[model samples]
Target: MPDLYSRRSFIAGVITAGMLSTATGYLLTRRTPVTLTLVTGGDATGGRSLLINLWNRFNPDVRLDVLTVNSSTRDQYDKFAGTRADIYNLDVIHIPRFAARGRIAPIDPPDGITLLAPVQRVSQVEEGSARLWAVPLNTDVGMLYRRITDKRATDAEPEIGRLVADRTQVRQLAAQLATEGSTTDEAFVINVLEQALAQDRTILDERGVVSTSLGQWQRALAPLAAALRDNRIVAVAGEEKTNAAFQERNLRYMRNWPVWFPAIDREERDKKPGTAAIRLGRLPIGVLGGQGLAVAEDTGYRDEAEAVIHFLTGMPAQKLLATYGFAPTASEAYNDPEVKAAMPHLEIVRSAVEDAHPRPMSAGYADFAQVFRQHTYDYLYRGVQLTDGFVEGMQGALR
Candidate 1:
């Protein structure tokens, strides 16, 4: 039986090799069909499957092999640097670094391609001069999730001024809810990192300068400190934990991404009698997040790769992505009746995306982020004050 199993494996290997050889022969002879390799991040949404199906139907002669890389953006860029993949789905934050390193090719979008104005701005990364480094795929932005109640949430979108006012209101609301028999310890939740980024107070500026001054850091973190002292805001570890706490109804208001709306809605629907109400609203500005399609510089099938990118970012594909739970980057996708019905607060999301700020576009952004995270965490959770010494340390880390 062992010998038979080994013999079967050998036969299968030979058959596979023969099939590959025949395909290579056909490719060499025909010169018409193109097989493009795409390396991208994991598909939490069903967008990738929809894209492949649409591509197969629209361009029958083009064969696409997608390799999903579920890792950090730095790791994704490293893998692209070492591989021969024709296209990449890169995190937009890393576009400047990848473009600077020449790991990805600059894009020249086809005529008639319409990108949401804000998405287009973020997709173009400048090395020496401004160039379209990637085509916008789906987009994401930070948002405020809260329990619906008798009092309407702020009608105005979230902005720095609004957030500041909201902080005070949240404290007042916590006191009011406590008086009204609420026993929860937390009234609001926000990530220190999100607040800092939303207010354009990153460790570094776009020009690779250390831009987070002592005054700026203090100003940016003052609200967080106030909330922590007042026990009005629960500082969670990250977005996942925050979302989990909110889902358990331990929180009244939370700052999170738009992706969690569907799950929150489901929870709201399943509420019995006195469950915490859930609703979604816009953050005046959030940290911009989403992936972009980039072609590798050395790809042999540049034309075909570009075509795949075009199909992925096109209106139909964007609509499909919206249907699959991703925030679309095309304006038309937000306007689609089906998409609107599915994502009821899409306009709020659109406003947030438009006003969202990208993280500092430095090659050393990972380092910058690390420094900010460490310092911010210490201040928010570990009882460290934003002193002159702390500010000095952060400045050094940014450098």
Candidate 2:
């Protein structure tokens, strides 16, 4: 078996090389009569290969050409658009924006099978709105990965804001926070959103606007602000730097998405007799992170694209991906024996996804994210807590 680095390189190469490619799991064959493109982020779980192969075998004439790009990069969104791909595996955060721009067409997914609560909510034009824009391929639930020495017991469930300030629980006060500067620090906003939710704050009112009194808003933000001020969570330069820090042994707790799970699973699977292990646990709330399948607005193959969506989201495809450790949007994946074996902490992931919430839904989500992050940066760092102006700006963006 390839070591971690080689495996990652192979994942990067993906389906781009086509039939003759010698990449580990992904293989290709003669070009089909009608080939549809599936553009998505770097799926580290290697689940896509299983799904793609299954798809090609089952739907022989219509093959999927998988293109995996670094969606986390700030400028990559255009690349996905330029592809004019048939099937876009869209990040949940981008759904509203994509839908509003007419970049992706809204389609009702297959009915009967239940999706995770948050997954169903996020499939809409905006949360609480009826238009269905996408069908979840798989789901993501962010987790806190802690590198423990001496076989430290996993908390399983942690009160994040309290954990940030609790010296006894966090023996070392340093954490590589996802917060760098405000721009594109979606995770920073997500972290605070999770913190605010933990404090029982209703982030948005019935009409879906930032709805908190000045005092209530400040109180909702207090724990995270205090933790940052006290240096319990150290703001790193960027996601890359933060992720690099997660590999080091000095840090106790790290916050990240499930894409990094393969590394932890590899470590546990390949550990030497005397080596230590990293364990994951439930974060207070995971602002739902994952992609859903949407048909590109310009696709000529709408029926075929919709069929592909139904096929991938169907139980068999979902289960294949789940067995490889992609978080299953369908609740039943939790009961699959192979999936359980692949992900030892499936319950932790299950719980995180269960308690998760979507980020404020708006077609102008980028604008909303910017406004929220700007004020949130002020709140977390400068201690400015007025929120009246912040609320006004968010309402403006939402409109």
Candidate 3:
């Protein structure tokens, strides 16, 4: 398997070679049909490849090229922004920012495209406007995964927020678990830093404008820092780390989507039998994120692209994608019995999608996102005051 550096180099070469060949004389001699490159982030590459294969069955003339970008959210944004790629497999939360940059073309509703209403509703650019910068592909919602045998797993199910609220209760539990030989290197894994800022209620103003204000973000980070400090939760950076801890029975609770559960199940089955049994619940009031597909602004075959997008989002394609363990972005798939059976978490994802909030929508919002990640870690893990650390970072980035 290719490592990160090699994959990046390969992707860069693919993009560069295509562009450079067109600039020179290679296009004239090349016998292959015109290729449409779709740049995407996230781990649905397998599902996307399947979708591309299905698309080729209809339009064999146009080849679809899939480029997998960075796995890290921040790195992925930088990679997408640095290159002038054709299509972006964007996270729904990131679409507003991409639109604000005018970096991509919008899918006009007047064109009579076959976009799913729920997909559109979740990613609507403006009310009654069909012009969308992106379309929903696979759903992903943040979920809280706790140990099945945790103290909170008594007769009554406890609300996750209430459990994480009181510092003493959390500390006492951690101490008891430690004394009882259940101590682990990492107690809890939470995406505290990322979710806090992006999921802030105050990030959006009354008129639906995105705010990157330091004060607003400072307030957001407070609860997160308190959780980490008092709850003894170790901050985790990515899905893999969170999954690893959960599978090892090291994590009492962690933030993740439905995708991680199955992978963890398999890993635990192979490594530790009992660890396979884990509990899932809704994200505590603030975690939301999902992925979507978008037509490249530069594709020559708009009509074909429209048809392909439509077909991929339709019932058949959604069912296939869901079978591969992806969250269906289409309502048809979300409502399907088979799809729901395959992914029981669809209900949770559905609620998250309907109530989901997009991240900051500024043209320079990617930059703002970076600041959110940086200052959040600084204040939450490094013991910097939420206000002082966050305010300085935001003022510098926004300026």
Candidate 4:
């Protein structure tokens, strides 16, 4: 059977290209130009850089009036739910929730819109349905970076054998090796130990929700607390601070978004080339993510809008993006020799993408992430009991 994306693309090409652009289509094409209102985060210039490039390259005859909204994530979601913006940069999961609410326009899969292939599989929209509500732009995935120096130290035959067999044993040896104090100076670091805990199978229910089973929580959370208590982790600061710490050599193995890792490696390498040790790995069983593109339901020039989207996601653009530090969503990019050379660790990210678990799709998902971050921070940093914090947040979302 053709995959969902291939099938949808065939259907869309046949219907949209043949039907929408018939002789009658010229009637609509010649009218006053329609402008697309794009609301995204960051400065308008930088925010729409990708789309603007596509617009310039494709020149769909439709004027794109990009509106880069400078607002907090929470503020943006509030505005979107209030039916304030026509198009916004949103997480993949939130698309379904908003679609279900009818606040945003339907993102019908058929016709001209270019939705990300991966997203189509997870989207709640029906197969062969022309109306699509959301699409992914750039996907983010979690990565495990370990200290190359530490990895080297443990390469001796005796240590290598032990490290490969069990992750727990590896971490324990790392913690001990880190304590030995060497002039080389490195430490194995990860996000607050709780992140590792969350990755364990015991913590998630069959539906992929956080499991409420008390036994599961204990089994998972215990090692995490111990890792934290043992100081194997650098304090779980937010992303900015965490990156800063890594650059400063305060961390060894850390969990970070793949997009930022190369930049981090570069910055460190420039200052201490071949000195600041670095290695990347697929996230261990958790912390997976990916990004894709979608067209707006409210885009007046649907054909033009899709033209721009398709050009952006097309093979050429995707290949270009891979050069600029982005992990390509298209599967083919992984095997490209040039892409592999530029990003040697691309396969690790590919594996991460393959296993990527999207965030929750509830209408309340954005709000849920806000609460979830708090729960993680409170337990990891603020000393709040893990169970109480997680339960409170989940219950609030359920409510």
Which of the numbered candidates is closest to the native, going by highest lDDT? 2
How do the residues 181-222 of candidate 1 rate in per-residue lDDT, one tens digit apiece? 111111111234455554554543333344546788777667
lDDT of 4 by residue, 167-231 (tens): 45323222211211121111111132224334464353222355555445545555555555555
lDDT of 3 by residue, 255-299 (tens): 666666655544444565444345566643433455666666666
Off by over 4 Å in 2: 1-32, 57-60, 67-79, 110-112, 125-131, 147-157, 167-184, 204-209, 237-240, 268-277, 382-387
Candidate 3 stretches greater than 4 Å from native:
1-33, 42-45, 75-78, 81-85, 108-122, 149-156, 168-190, 193-220, 269-271, 388-399
Q: lDDT (0-100) at residue 7 of candidate 2? A: 41
**What TM-score against the true fold does each predicted structure earn?**
0.74, 0.78, 0.71, 0.71
Error of 2 at 362 (Å): 1.3
Error of 4 at 94 (Å): 2.1
In order, the Cα lDDT scores of the candidates are: 0.61, 0.66, 0.52, 0.49
RMSD of each: 12.0, 6.1, 10.3, 9.9
Q: Which stretches of candidate 4 lie over 4 Å from their true place?
A: 1-30, 43-51, 57-60, 81-86, 106-119, 124-132, 149-199, 205-207, 274-277, 290-294, 370-378, 381-396
Please write out the lDDT profile of model 2 over residues 117-172, one tens digit for every residue.
Answer: 77888787656664579898888866777665555654454556677657554333
The superposed Cα distance between candidate 3 and the true structure at residue 286, in angstroms, equals: 3.7
Q: How accurate is candidate 3 locally (lDDT)?
A: 0.52
* Model 1 alpha-carbon drift over 4 Å, by segment: 1-34, 57-60, 73-75, 125-131, 149-190, 197-210, 229-231, 271-277, 387-399
